[model samples]
Target: MRQQSSPHLSRGFSSYGCALALAALVALAACSKKEAAAPAPRPVVASIVHPDGQALQAGSLPGEVQARYSTPLSFRVGGKIIERRVRLGDTVKNGEIVALLDPADAQKNAASAQAQLDAAQHNLVYAQQQLERDKAQAKENLIAPAQLEQTTNAYASALAQRDQAQQQAALAKNQLQYTTLVAGHAGVITAEQADTGQNVSAGQAVYNLAWSGDVDVLCDVPESALAAFAVGQNASVTLAALPGRKFSARVRELSPAADQQSRTWRARLTLAQPGPDVRLGMTADVTPAVPLATAAAQHGLFTLPATALFHEGRQPAVWVVRAADNTLELRRVTVTRYDERTIVVSEGLKDGESVVLQGVHTVSAGEKVRAIAPLHPEDFAS
Candidate 1:
């Protein structure tokens, strides 16, 4: 090609093109400057306020109304139900007739027993006369002593038969009395199964009666919460049907034994005035009384949702303020008490420090997070 083509000349020309292209790219990229990463989303705002010293998280539990006296209906003898004197919703007094059983067979047996007793007594009297005659003959040496003794034994056997017959008659009379059923207490009849002429076995229930006595609300508190209950303790009861009325009550009994299936103990609360308006089987609310967990003078105690609590091994800890930086702190807390809704934090928190009350599952100790207020301000109390 021409005089030794200038290598530097061609190389410089290629380098100049490459530099021009790179400069164009730099200018275009500057013009495009990528939008600043979208500012992080803001957390939802919440309303929080300081609580009063006397404020409390009043918790409630579901319970049922119950009668203090629940009695079973039964009969002493088996027979066909001839007449039913009472039905469900019947008001009855002590000794009132509830039902009647067929007494034909019983009466017949009783009459037969009496006949047997009379016959045995007559035979006994005749045997005694014969024994006396034989003894007198023995005294006159007309009969042998063995013969008199035989007559004496005959009289004794007849007397024994008479006594047994008499007892049988008495038992028959008692069985006949069972034919007329009677109420054992003043109560309102809750059920009646036996109808006229229905065959019933002994001790069969004919009526369900709820006796008049101290009414109560029975609540089965779980064994885990039973230790706080005792006899004579105070309770607050509310009826489901009557919304406004609340009856004060006293604990009648706290069963020491736990139910086999539910693992709960029965707590009986006697209502102060379970008015005539109250009915059996109606549902109620029973709240166990708790003593002041801390000093009554306490003010502004920390509170949190139970889910906000996380465990480190077996120790209970909560997320709290750590340092001047906005970092989460795993503050160990002494949890004194809790209800179904909220947990009571007794220690390890101060009044003004922010505590994570919710959404603790995503955050961890020393991690950075936005602090927000609780869902329900009323949940926290002093």
Candidate 2:
């Protein structure tokens, strides 16, 4: 009986062992499935950096449209402005009267000068008759030689006085003409310094005239940007008031000295051919089209698309791709500046290194990626 019971217990123990082995096999199969379901490396777009050959960027700055030949118009004589024939923004032809001074005093002086000349002429005639009579008397031995000498001296003095009166009359006529302030050239009035009923002195600027001619885009450049500009350099100008229109220009003048108050160099870009739409005092945007060689030297900066920039807190950073394995690593960079199209990286980037241009946010550290060439190198600059 004991031998039979031992065989039953051994069979039960064998069954329990079989169940434990099955459970172990099932656990092993679940572990294999989890390993197979592991996520694959995320695919991301990137580009190889050709930092050295990147084109130098173009820059834009605020500017203003101004007349190339602006001058202050003034009257040559002093008086009250009785009439202003031209108003601000009025176009005037050469020699066209712009303002008028009261002619009452000038006319009075002219009349007085004429009267004095008439009196002098009458005196000269009398003196001449007296001299002639004295000479005749002397010839006839009816008068002393001293009387003839006195008559001759009086005639000479009268002749001198007559000549002086004539000069005074001419001067008075000139003063009267000067009362009419006329435009020296065909131009548009930009400013009116004096108005009707206001007294102005000689040469006091009464009207600011902008001569009709070539136009200029005026801008003030800081000391740092002065090196980027030179005379004869080509540029493009666009007016804020006239959208979608671009005018060609060239650097015509550069101030030799910096402005004392602003410490900036005043630059003037003359338009090649300005149309009627281009008016004086219109705001403009001046973009200097610097040559690639000159620009590269002036701006030795690495440029990347603005999208490539990522902010880690307040710090700016970018994702650099490893060339060997196509993996990414977040790199902190010192940004020099940024414009509408590109971010200028001043430091923390080496030449000939790879950087992820797009999908910067989608990438993770050490994730594999596929590097694709950009459509154009300049796109990176943008």
Go through the candidates in order and give each one's C-alpha lDDT. 0.73, 0.83
What candidate 2 gets wrong by more than 4 Å, as runs, is 1-58, 129-148, 291-382
Q: Distance from true position, residue 121, model 1, in Å? A: 1.5
Off by over 4 Å in 1: 1-58, 242-244, 260-262, 291-382
How do the residues 120-205 of candidate 2 rate in per-residue lDDT, one tens digit apiece?
99999999999999999999999999999999999999999999999999999999999999899998999989889999999999
In candidate 1, what are the lDDT values of residues 80-196, reduced to their tens digit? 887887888878999999888889999998899889989998999999899889988998999888898899999999989989998998998899898889999999898776777
Structure candidate 2, residue pairs in collision = none
The top-ranked prediction according to TM-score is: 1
lDDT of 2 at 186: 94
What TM-score against the true fold does each predicted structure earn?
A: 0.62, 0.59
Which 10 successive residues of model 1 have the least lDDT summed? 44-53
In model 1, pairs of residues that clash are none
